[model samples]
Target: MTITIYGIKACDTMKKSFVWLDQHKVEWQFHDYKKAGTNKKDLQRWIKAFGWETVINRRGTSWRKLPEDTRASMDASGAISAALQNPSLIKRPIIEGNGILEIGFDPAHWAELF
Candidate 1:
């Protein structure tokens, strides 16, 4: 399976994930959402697979910086829109391969997956 890891390249969690994946010799592509941006279809698919709550980093500054109305009205679609506009709001290092989806960095869990 071809693995694709998605995140902002500058994020600390993404840096750790990069080291781990390289150390483990997992060949994968990167989607730097901050630079290249992401599409609606993939976002929707990810949201369906992982749930918006898992995909969105509500604790991040990107989310907190939003207007109160925007924050309060964040349903799945709202999350998708928000993430598209501000990729930093996405939790770091969402790794995916064929039939494989991982939302965050967990060394133990990744060891099992790898």
Candidate 2:
């Protein structure tokens, strides 16, 4: 499968994912949202597959830094808006390939995925 990994370049988990993919001889491309930014369509797709709870990184500093009202008021559209405004609010290292869609960096899960 042709793989594309979406994440911030400097993320520690992203670094590990890079190494894991390399070690497994998986040829992949990086989509650094920090540079290129994520779009509403992609966010919508991921949310549809994994649910908003999985697509959004609620435990991250970016989420924690949001105003209380914003967090409290978050719904599907609100989450999409927040994530579009700040890509860091989305979970790191989302791997998409062919029919595959996954979030987070778990080496064991990745082994099974590939």
C-alpha lDDT values of all predictions: 0.90, 0.92
User: Which ten residues in a row are the worst by lDDT in model 1?
Assistant: 84-93
Error of 1 at 87 (Å): 1.1
Global CA lDDT computed for model 2: 0.92
Off by over 4 Å in 1: none
Per-residue lDDT of candidate 1, residues 1-114 (tens digit):
569999988889999999999999998899999789988898899899889998899888888899999988888999999888888888888999887898999989999999
**Model 2 lDDT-worst window of ten:** 47-56
* TM-score, candidate number 1: 0.95
Using all chains and alpha carbons, the TM-scores for the candidates as numbered come to 0.95, 0.96
Candidate 2 residue lDDT tens string, 1-114: 679999999999999999999999998999999999999999999988888888889999999999999999888788899999999999998999888888999988989888
**In model 2, how many backbone clashes occur?**
0
Candidate 1 local accuracy as lDDT?
A: 0.90
